[model samples]
Target: MNGTLIFDGGCGFCTRSRNLLTRLDRHGRVGTVPFQEDGVEERTGLRPDQLAASVWWLDADGGRCGGAEAVNSALSAALGTRLPLLVYRLPGMGRLQEAVYRWVAANRYRFPGVTPWCQQHPAGCRPA
Candidate 1:
């Protein structure tokens, strides 16, 4: 219960990214689930927007972090990476990175992970 890595399993890019992280994670620590799946919200107690807005990390202690911070956490937990954690803390990097992440989330359909149909009807595309 160290933490739970969450992603938009409905997104094509998110699915691919999860696959890559699973491969790179030598410790097998990159456990993830898409919030759109059944029972996920009840299980995680995360609000809907928390899942839709960005990738998230639900810490073992119940702390929540999303977007770039979540990425940093996943890497750190799964691969013990420290560089991104360090770089993100520099002066204005956090705010800038978060804004960029929001933009990417908003435009995810244009990326490789989503199809036009899925984007059009997100309700039907989640895991069964």
Candidate 2:
């Protein structure tokens, strides 16, 4: 389960989530990448448009996941348990999760007190 987890670098919410993942992934099983970092697009083959649309998880097997599924994968791996079990079992959960992810992706900038940079370049903020 070695792969990179790519996230929106600029969003405050995203950064906080990354921090949580970092703490949980103390075993170094997961790698984190902020979409705004240099060469991220080239390394991951994910364009800015695509990165901005959803979070991405590139699995060790070369499989790619996006939106809530990606998030669930990352969380499950980091949690090392069945925390994401419900997401995997519920009927229609994948479609519903993707739809919710899309709505959030589209409206992320509207979050209160978001930085101007985040509003302008939602895909380019990389975690520090």
Candidate 3:
């Protein structure tokens, strides 16, 4: 994989979304890793708060992109398409996209599909 998709392991929405994206990603350009994985912070240069707030993408050379932009770029690369990336960059859309991402991320645990394990660690979970 050329990119590593760093996301929250404790989030139902994030895990489900990553799975959905993986299936959509026929090109298999990216690999998924939870923010809690060993050495993740060292590898991605991300603080815990930063990792908790958004999904992030790390390039082979260690270049990093976070939040909605990271999501769009990872999807685009994985599918070998530009339309998704283009849509994410449409004029006046960035703010709205980021807002939605933030909302979903903050409230991910409330959604269904959350594993029992993820729910067990309330303190480990992101802002509910």
Candidate 4:
């Protein structure tokens, strides 16, 4: 269940989403980081634009998935079930998930979001 969830630090919506994920992750099995942080690209091998486009999940074993798939992975780990992943794999469900995720991502700013966590707690944002 251990993994890293990379997200957009500048986007309030993304930050809030990460916070929600943290709450659901009672076990703290998933670690989250903002892609804007220094060396994130080097550590994840993901470009800035790619990270900006969608959330990413990097499993402990080095496996990676982005967009809706990433969400599925994070949720599965947090909830301790593969239901999300299973549903996502169902026929036509993947496309539906992708479309919905893209829509939300595109209109994320419209939804209410808290201030970026890093801006509020700079010292705690970066990994030591």
Q: Which candidate gets the maximum TM-score versus the true structure?
A: 4
Q: What is the C-alpha lDDT of each candidate?
A: 0.75, 0.75, 0.78, 0.87
Give the candidate order by descending TM-score: 4, 3, 1, 2
Candidate 4 regions exceeding 4 Å error are 123-128
**Candidate 1: regions farther than 4 A off:** 114-128
Candidate 3 or 2, higher lDDT: 3
Q: Write the per-residue lDDT of candidate 4 for residues 1-128, one digit (tens) a residue.
A: 67989987777888899999999999878899888777888999988789878899999999999999999999999888889999999999999999999999888878888998678767655542
Would you list the clashing residue pairs of candidate 1?
Answer: 12-113, 13-113
* Candidate 3: tens digits of C-alpha lDDT, residues 1-128: 36889888877768778778889878778888878666777877889889878889887777888888888878877888777779988997877888888787778878876553245555544433
Q: How displaced is residue 31 in candidate 2, in Å?
A: 1.3
Candidate closest to the true structure, highest lDDT: 4
* lDDT of each residue in 1-128, candidate 1, tens digit only: 24778888767877777777777788766677777766777877778887887898887787778898888777777776667778888899989989998888898757885443245456745633
As for model 3, its CA RMSD to the true structure in angstroms is 4.0
What does candidate 2's lDDT look like per residue over 1-128, in tens digits?
66788887677667667778879986777787777777878877888889877889988888888888888888777777656846665898878888888887787756643343344555555543
lDDT of 2: 0.75
Candidate 3 residue spans exceeding 4 A from truth? 114-128
Score candidate 3 by lDDT: 0.78
Instruction: List candidate 2 segments past 4 Å from native.
Output: 82-86, 112-128
The 10-residue segment with the lowest total lDDT in model 4: 119-128
